[model samples]
Target: MNTLSKKNDLIDEFDIIAKFFTPLAKDAPGTFGLLEDAAILPTIDSHQEWVVTVESIVCNVHFLPNDPFELIARKALRVTLSDLAAMGAKPYGYTLTIALNRDLSDSCYLLEKVSHGLTIDQAEFGIHLIGGDSVSTDGPITLAITAFGITNKAKALRRSAAMPGQDLWISGTIGDGALGLQVAKGILSKQYSDLAGRYRLPQPRISLGCRLSEIAAAAIDVSDGLILDASHIANQSKCRLVIDGGALPISESVSRIIADHSEMFELILTGGDDYELLFTAEPEAIQKIKQAGYELDIPITRIGRVDSGEGVDVLDHNGIKLNLLIEPGWTHF
Candidate 1:
């Protein structure tokens, strides 16, 4: 749980992995270097240098086999892009690392489908596929993307700068992606299929994040479920994240689905793949975000406040607290 052991574990993995290539890093670079799409390299001509981030997804873990190829590819790219968006970075290019199970690689049909999926995402995002590697593996298919982006040095947003009393706001709704995965797996009935789609294909809030660049003090994409991701922000900023569950914009469609399968709400809470922007800003900046016509279609809902507390808590309309007793969201082992 401590940072040193966590890092040493990574170095151990990299040592095993370096058999394939030169050790990509020597000493690890802290959290952002530890996660995200790619490390923010030190710049010489610093004014025009770009921001970078990377993300990875694995089959049987991040996606179901029955998921469409296009959906899978798009999701792979969007998830990484979500990190860039959270940093208010502009799209530049990407590098891919695709590892296929021997069975999948042997099938031309499957390969073509996966390739087309990557093609569509690259074209839509205007990102060039600069380079990448293909490797054979015995495990499930794995797709990793490292997206490079540019931003004015002054405009970049990060997870470590939030202040106390800042308002917490989220772009789009939460829980849909987790619900979407359930629907995809047939765990949820067909009547609730939309939730399934959300999981398979998440829309990275790129444009909106870029627009709010100047205002947002701290930001992150909700990938490993809302509760865990928000906890990340709180822990990093050293502030308590108190979320109003009543104000949570649970979609009507999701509410209807919930009526039938009540347990699904827990799935929504800890569900991953909701690539929306969860951010904090000053009250004045928040009002500016509202009036600036940035969130044209996406709803930026203010669900809570950041204060001096230890962890995350949810409250109802009457201010009564609710328990999210479940364990934390996704953790890579």
Candidate 2:
């Protein structure tokens, strides 16, 4: 398990981490052995603990090479912030690493736009740029962001805390990001500006995450699509997750796409980039969860149930298990 070996049809990212980086991370007390979404540092002055997470995005791979610099910058920062939200930590600050192609004529202008985008998100998320690094590169532009947050809770919510019999809930809608990517690439015929926006600027559920820390048993952000992310919870918690396909909440735009191209349903289920929160809670906390969503004006939907088993099951409205049509979500290498 600690070595990276070819598994079935694909390479497992966790196996790579466990082999290459887990040893190094284990040397640091607060690194969580590189197993958790974010690392938690000890409480400072007996008050709050620090939670840190980092993510990187490469040009053309993560975003179009010609995408607006502002959106690119915003997406880079917000995605990391979403990690903080998942741990129920409040934003503290972030550092950015940028690799730029100095030969491009508009490189300077693109950097300026990127900075502007970061500025806007800093204000919106109540965080500031603390530090970063820059370098010249001949390849596509790359961005790496490390964000930190502080939480007063004794321990941050964890993916491994889910239990059998807990109800699985998700915040807001899903599949918009996948649909947005389709619109951006011109793969889908229907063009909706909102879908494109979802692809570019994901709304991180920071507020809801904070509230769920008290009510939820386990939590994770839906960055890599619903099924894949849910499976993360299942794997970590050692339980089976049964999801009702009909209960999946999607935007009107996504619904229209589904109606036109039924095959795209797999994309909705497996496509990545939806930065929503997928969490689990006890049945008794349902009312409190609903109240929190209602008070915050964020929609929360119960789409699945946790059971005594392993992996996940996607069931139709008629209760028949559905076959997977694609790999679950996005993966690097």
TM-score for each predicted model, relative to the true structure: 0.83, 0.86
Candidate 2 on 1-333: residue-level lDDT in tens? 122123222235565445333533343455555666555544565667888999998988889876788999999999999999999998777767777764666554665677678778877987765545556666778999998888875758899999989999999899999999888888875458788889889998888888988899889998887888989999999999999999999999999889988989999888978999999999999999999999999999999999999998999999999996579888877
Q: What's the CA error at residue 227 for candidate 1, in Å?
A: 0.9
Residue pairs in clash, model 2 = none
The deviation in Å at residue 68 for candidate 2 is: 0.8
Overall local distance difference test of candidate 2: 0.81
TM accuracy, model 2:
0.86
> Which parts of model 1 are misplaced by more than 4 Å?
1-46, 292-295
- The lDDT of each candidate is 0.73, 0.81
Span of 10 residues, lowest total lDDT, candidate 1: 1-10
lDDT of 1 by residue, 110-155 (tens): 5456556766776677765554555656677788888888888778
